[model samples]
Target: MRRLRMGMIGGGPGSFIGPVHRIAAELDREIELVAGAFSSNAGRSRAAGEQYRIDPSRAYADVAALIAGETARADGVDFVTIVSPNHHHLPAARAALAAGIPVLSDKPATATLAEAQELADVVRGAALPYALTYTYSGYPLVREARARIAAGALGTIRKVVVEYPQGWLAGEASGKQAEWRVDPARAGEGGCIGDIGVHALHLAEFVTGLRVTELLADLAAVVPGRALDDDCTVLLRFENGARGVLLTSQIEIGELNGLRIRAYGDRGGLVWKQEEPNSLTLYDLDGGCSMVRAGTALLGADAAARTRTPGGHPEGYLEAFANLYRDFAALLRGEPAPLLPGIEDGLRGMAFIATAVAASRDRAGWVPLSV
Candidate 1:
């Protein structure tokens, strides 16, 4: 099998997500990092290329130069991965697609909803394979949960509760990651909500197969002098009439990446947590509860297909993230990929952010989620 070549943007020094993308994309041995514009500074970008051990000649100063250089080569990159801050996602994706390269971008689509909307048009015009790394959806157990819900094991979903909380920003913070996330010019109008809150919202909807139609939100900047929201609570109305609550905060002291979701239906309930990615909990109407472990025989085809190990062995964050890349490889090879989040998911997530921000800012009781 031929390995697809990948070019990256923004995984410069000290970037947390950039290295993760490289590792995950190569884990299945189906992709290779061939080039990148790793940072805004020309010197730093070249240094990062050397660190990745790629040909330093392929390291460019910006997206435009990268596109020009790569597209001119017969062995150019098979796709482009955008790991920059929210603000850079649009231009990078647009440039790659226009140059006839596929795109895989990090979450929240773009800095603002308007940019996401524009990117949608660009993607459609390019008619190429574009995906968003909604990493949790790649977990084996999470796939099982989705399969069970889709199979009617959960009956009619009546309610949902999802949350993502972290304590790193509970006090004063200073770092490349923290700086870009809190800046509205880079992170958009949402802070915690745009960052982790969008993940919770996507997870709830993805597992339950429900779309959030309306929501009432309360957003706050928990830490003094912060320019964007650090905490938020949202009440949701699903298209099928299911109710939901989403809570996301960066100022919760001592907490880590505790993302969890619970959904109840007429016949039962389902639970999945990010910390414990290997197991899913299911409840029966008769007060019976069961745990479904990943790599077990009880899992559906979707879960089994993604599972890499047998029962009792754990597959974690890196593996989960790798699933997306592996499946994307299949997609580019003309194979089926039912769960890959694409431009539409990107649009919906941005709409969620915009709607939540508007509802909270305007004190609107409830607002429709429209892109």
Candidate 2:
């Protein structure tokens, strides 16, 4: 198959997610970084292009020019990826899709559920592939956990608990990383919940094949003077009558990026921790304990395809992130959407964020979801 041409918006100088996106798209060898708009600043966009050997002339000033220029070119980018701030995503994605270009965006679909719903219409109407990167579901073991649960290894899921904690906001962080995210105008409402808690929300549903129907939440601004939530605890009711809890925070001092999940059923339970991505611990109803290690010879093809290197070589965050890119590229190349999280998944994520925010008011009362 011919290599897919890829472009980007909002991942220019000092954007932590841009380089990560580039390297990820590069991993599958089926994608090529042919062009991009990079940043709104002309000089910065040119500089960002120079790093990838894109001629300065094609490095446009903004999304409008990027879409117009790239579309008019003979060898236009087959698709675009949006890695901009929360508020910028809807416009950028709409432009690319309107121009008949596919899109892969960072999570939280849009700044608001209304915008997300509109974008979802565009995606469905255009018959274009749109994906949201929920990094955890890209893990091989997480996929394995989903498969096991689906196959009845864990019957009648009774509970699901996911926790994502980070130390990034443990104190004030300066520079591009912390500034825009903490700024309500750029990051949208519900800081910690939208940014990280949504990740946990997506992970639980993706693995369990269950939807969170109603939630009671307690969202807090643990950071002394922060404008939005930095800690959130959500009580959940699944469509299947399963109960769940999601606890996420950005103020857990020294915890670093710790994401963990535990799902239990009448027949068994399974656990996976993001810090230790390669191992899954299982508990049977009869007290049989087993560990399913990644790269083990006995696993099925799905897990094997995702396992790179040997059993103990320590493939991590970059690889997990890349998994989303690989799947997106595959789908853009005419394959099925990667069963992980995509645009619909992103819409669900936005729903969780918006619902959590609404629930947080009235002292974090219960909110019913349309999912």
- Candidate 1, superposed: residue stretches over 4 Å from native: none
Q: Which pairs of residues clash in candidate 1, taking residues 3 or more apart in a chain or in different chains?
A: none
lDDT of 1 by residue, 279-320 (tens): 899999999999999878898888898999888888989998
The candidate that achieves the highest lDDT relative to the unseen native structure? 1
Alpha-carbon TM-score of each model against the true structure: 0.99, 0.96
lDDT of 2 by residue, 1-371 (tens): 78888988878888898888888788878788878888889889988998878767777889999989989999899999888888998999988998999999988888878888888888888888888888887888988999899899999999999999998887885788887777888888769998898899988998898999999988988778888888899999999999999999988889888999999999999999999998999999999999999888856667778877778777777788788888887787677755856667877888888888887877657779874
Model 1 error, position 273 (Å) = 0.8
C-alpha lDDT of residue 347 in model 1: 93
Judged by whole-model lDDT over C-alpha atoms, candidate 1 comes out at 0.92
